[model samples]
Target chain A: MRQHLKKAGIILFWLLVWQLVSLLVHNSVMLVGPVETIKCLCRLVVTADFWLSIWYTFWRIGLGFLCASLLGILLAFAGAKKLILGEFLSPFFAALKSVPVASFVVLLLIWFGSKNLSFFTSLIVVLPILYGSTREGLANNDKKLLEMAQVFRIPFGAKLHYILLPGLSPFWKSAFSLALGMCWKAGVAAEVIGQPLQSIGNRLYQAKIYLETGDLLAWTVVIILLSFGVEKAFARLLRLLPGEEKKEPDSMKEKGDVA
Target chain B: MTIQVDHVSKFFDGQPVLDNFCMELSDGNSYLLTGPSGSGKTTLLRILLGLTRPDSGRVRLLGDYKYSAVHAGVVFQEDRLCEPFSAVENVAMVSKKLSPRIAREALEKLLPADALDKPVRELSGGMRRRVAIVRALCVPSDVLLFDEPFTGLDRENRKKAIDLILAEKGSVPLLITGHSDEDLGFCHPIDIRTGVPLQMG
Candidate 1:
């Protein structure tokens, strides 16, 4: 809510200036009013095609992000435990992080069909962020606490659930939040270039084809809102995970056997 | 079980922190580890904890190697509690089955009772020191190793912390390292000088 309130204040301040600029310019073609954009959004929302377009893009982009996060977390754990594996993956992660999104989109389009284009693009963008943050968090974990756990013969599952998870949560959550936003932006950009059917990117391509700047702007708003909603939802989900609660004595028990 | 150190030598950057040091604990009992600064008191504790290996010789327990049994519970000079977590959570991180009331009781002896709910970062230096000692005691270990466990506490807090350490179960042995004469009053510490002693804690 704090973030939303801050966002609302910023957008309102910018919108007031945008409205004044549109009125002074006296041309919707040059600079559209916020109200006009809202009107365009409302009109698009009434259509089933627009809703389908939104869902199609959302699924593809969301899947890519999910895949990236899972693999990134697994790889991070592996890389943290083994120096050789970490060394092997270093240049590979660096390459993915430094490469341009457009370049990857073009290369991936040639490799995969346009239908799954956004999925691949999202993975490429999200992977390095999750991997880097998780590795750093694991490396900087409370070494003394780990030693204490070892001396006490703490159950392996308990060590992961209690010590490792709490330590890694902040890094994972922040990386996931940023990566979610990046994946959505890059995924949409890829879709716009590829023009997948029943997708927001395809709608954007259509708008540009017909010179409908308002349609382009409206679809852009839908993409942003959907991405923001997902990020907020995921953050809530992260909080709900069992490992997140700091006060473990209240809830933690011998949950089966330690691996 | 006895912890025996036999002719162990340790060097950091070739400075010879400890040379041919040795000590033997008779059995499960209390011991005060005392030495001058740079006498390798902390390094000896680290060797006992298996955190640092001796450059030569070995530390063994009951004729077995160190870490072979549930060896030692260590309290370092620094209060290394997790900053974002409550003092109780920091303790619980090491001892999963550690009861809340038990942890509270352990902390209550050395700290203000109200500090149980506060994060370690919000705690005062003395309070964190107490928490660290409580954490080490909370873990069920065969031998307790404390490194400068009474650094910042005033006389009142120090007595309380020492009392808490005494309150722990007797089956586990306690070895403490400190520079204060008052700290040595609780147990007759074998005086260790620079270079190597023929005995160990």
Candidate 2:
């Protein structure tokens, strides 16, 4: 309850600032007021194109994020178990992490057309984070627990499920939370630069091109909601996996066996 | 039917823990290894459990390679129970799946039935110690190693935990290290002193 109240207070405080800024700006094109932006949002909601663009941008980026996360986890497991493989991937992952996003996007545009540029860009951008964080999570886990598991003759799968997953969940959460936002932003950026028709990023680019400030503000709101909504959904699923395990602790043994 | 430790010795930074240590146990029996704090009790246990290597000599089981402890179960001094798992799951972790009734029955002797549902992280320190005891005992193993199993438990809880071990794991060739006579009640402890074999002085 305290958290909810804190969040409500922050929202109200920000809305008051938006109201003040809107009144000061006066010119509608220069900055669309929050009230007008909401009105513009409601108007756009009635259109089929807006929904299509939202879904399009959402799924494409969602796919890229999923691909990177799954492969990252798999690679982390491999690298953890095999020192040689882990050493081999060190420089590659390091370079991937240090390389700027703009450079990847520009290079990807040349390799792939604007339509699929965002998809590839999202994959390249999120992979290093997922890899690095999951690797660190695996490496940072308590060695004592692993020794105990070994002495107990725990099966390989059980070790991964019980020992490995719980250890990695925190890192995975942070990695996914951060990577989800980046994928959406970079995916949209790719679309904007590439100007793929019938996409949210394309719509955003068009808004900027014509100086349709109301449309621009409305689209920005859509992007924020999409990104925020998706992240919340992922976090909810994460909370639920452990939540469902809570009601019956013993059942977790079976789940742990499968984990 | 027996484990053989032929002239096994280990040193860390030139300090010997197991200096030409030799011992053997056949079939089902238990031995309490009494030694000073750093007198290789844990190092010996680790070698027997295949988690460490000796500087000289080797451990063999029934004339087999030393990796045999891949089948051994161990209860460490720090109660290496998974903090997020309940008492029952921690024991059931190594057992066959589909909710073994033995797992529930194992914790019944040492922990409250309600604790079977609470994660070990929520349990008190003494409670976690009991859970670790249950885990090592419930799972099948030819051998078990306990490194000072009853260090921090209160007298009453320690006695109860000891009783649970005797009842659950009868004659399991257990190797334990502790100064307390409480553990000696369960088995005859073989004293290993550092500078030389324990003298009667």
Candidate 3:
């Protein structure tokens, strides 16, 4: 198709520009071309150590993301149900939102060491995002649905399944999209600082130390690919959930029931 | 089941909505609540449905069982259906006794068969209202409430909806709030403003 060819042409043009820039620099340490970066990636992919590092980093960051999501959901429900709990947690959330990631990274590195440094870092980075979105979602639940449930005497289980889940799904999607990217960035930064034994961050650090700009670019590309891939996969899984396919029409909504 | 609203008083922003309201609702009879807007008709219904608390007096359900145990089905003024769910899912989600087949059959009387599987959000307002009506009727409850349930329905569909309600409802009390006196056959009209029952021809 013309569109595909156009996309290919655009990509090739960018690659050509990068190759020219690298030739003009004439210093491999200063700039790595796309070809060298791809070659470095090809060499890295066949190694056992590379796969081990990928797995280690993947699971640590993934576990942090999972933990943050669960906690965020629980806290959201608790805050929505009890006003006092929401008030009590306001300062904590504010502090979490305002505190610098680098400060936490340094402190966490000293306290917990490098083994779980990335885990805690990712959790901290993602928690407030998911929590805030979840709380907003719960707060914005349709009051009409609540009244209907009350009058119909719909059971708690049915209300949760039919109303709450569908209502909160948009918030979940947005939260997950943002949290995924944040988790990967903060997680890799943590690993770079903490220098975990078998991690992509450690590889990136070593590449920088050895002046292997191609390896550094390849590792950076890998992070971007993994982050985007995970986000897409998670969004797909969310779409597969029951009742998630029903999207609100932008314009033709019934006058009174838009809420 | 008998619903007794005894000297119930409710105030919003220091203004009385339901002042010394009293009423008796008996089973096997449908009550048509006719009142002007802001006459506390909805407030009375909310109190009866246990959604609001009265500042004074109490609403008692005098029967063999406790008032809290009795379930009341409601067709809200707005079709308060789960937007993403199909008509069958919306009906069956609240029903403990009626199967999906029975709910589908009940909905088929008021809606086209092809519209049954579509999400309630995609359906027109009339169709959604019918879905709400079917949802209320199909559920296992001791009483039924309809708050302007016929707002967007055509005359023919309104009649069909009424027939569906009558067909599905048993001896349980059905209380409906309507602005017009037309099409209120066999229903005891009660004026919430005067606290007096109006005689109907």
Candidate 4:
């Protein structure tokens, strides 16, 4: 409770600073305070279009993220099995990591158009991260444990449940946290460029065109909330997976051994 | 099943770990491998499990085996229990034939009931070693290879563990590597350095 109150107090302090800056500027067009942004958000939430825009962006990006995660895991397994495939795809993933999101957005717009821009953009943005993390996780699995499994002639299903999943958990947790945020930022950017209909990005574009600072800030706030909500929800879902429990710390183990 | 290690030699960095080693492990017998540290005890176990390749010579399985490969239940030098999993999970994970109930019962012989559900990492070294021993015994196999299984175990716990292993081994060839032959008088002692069976007085 104290930690939560401390967080809220910190947020209030920032909000006060923002309000003072806006008042000194004295131009609502250039800057809007937290109050005005909240008021705009309240007005916008009553409209069906607002909800529609959210649904449109949410499902497309969510589906894209889902597809990327699945494909990335499959490809990582394949790559781990085939050394040549891993060697072959190394440069491609490297290029994907380094290429500008804007370049991909523009290219995707030309090829696929605005209808599914967010979907494709988010998929491309998230795939390499999941793939790399999964591959690293596979590489980091304990060789001794694997040898034990092999000697025991344990079935593949049991090996996956007992060994592979637990080894992959930490890597996937960090990768999901990172990829979730990147997919949203890239997905929304793609929508803004493509000017997709019934999208938060489209509204953001419109807000920019008319210089509606309040709407722009309100939409930004919405994006932040949506990103945070999806991350938390995804984390909760990951915790539900079997074999995802926290391991006892090494210090505790050492102390036990000493005793 | 009989394992034939005929003139097997392994070299690492131009040093002979197992120089012209030979041993024939037959069914319904137990062998205790005794050697000083860095005397290729672990390398021999790894060779038997097919985890490492002998630079010269071959290992063969002579038996009326249905499969071409030898299925072994091995306890590595290190406690290779999945650190995040409980002792019961570790034991039961090796084979579907061994249910959680069976695992719990077997573990109760060597470990306390309360430590059965806690993650093996939270357990002491002695407890974790017991979990590894139980895991090896729970699996169905043609042979059992345990390397330094008595590490981190007390005299009482070691006696209990040996009793459990003997009771559960089920006529398979049991090869254990350790430093001393005092606790393992029942097992035929093999000097790993010389690759010869020592006479039991």
TM-score of chain B of each: 0.89, 0.86, 0.93, 0.95
List model 1's recovered fraction of native interface contacts, to 2 decimals.
0.45
Candidate 4 C-alpha lDDT tens digits along A1-259? 9999999999999999999999999999999999999999999999999999999999999999999999999989999999899888767887898999999999999999999999999999999999999999999999888877887888989998889988998899999999999999999999999999999999999999999999999999999999999999999888755576644465688899999
Which ten contiguous residues of candidate 1 chain A have the minimum total lDDT?
A250-259
RMSD for each of the candidates = 6.3, 5.3, 5.0, 4.1
> What interface RMSD does candidate 1 have?
3.1
- The pairs that clash in candidate 1 are B22-B199, B22-B200, B23-B199, B23-B200
- How much is the lDDT of residue B96 in candidate 1? 56
Docking class of predicted structure 4: medium
Greater lDDT among 1 and 3 belongs to: 3
Return the candidate ranking by lDDT, descending. 4, 3, 1, 2
Q: Which model scores highest in lDDT? A: 4
> Which consecutive 10 residues in model 2 chain B have the weakest lDDT in total?
B192-201
DockQ per model, Cα: 0.33, 0.47, 0.69, 0.76
lDDT of 4: 0.90
Measured by TM-score, how close is model 3 to the native structure? 0.91
TM-score for candidate 1? 0.87
Instruction: Give one clash count per candidate, in the order shown.
Output: 4, 1, 0, 0
Q: Report lDDT (Cα) of residue B119, candidate 4.
A: 81
User: Residue B71 error for model 3, in Å?
Assistant: 1.9
Model 2 interface CAPRI class? acceptable
Where does candidate 2 clash, by residue pair?
A: A161-A259
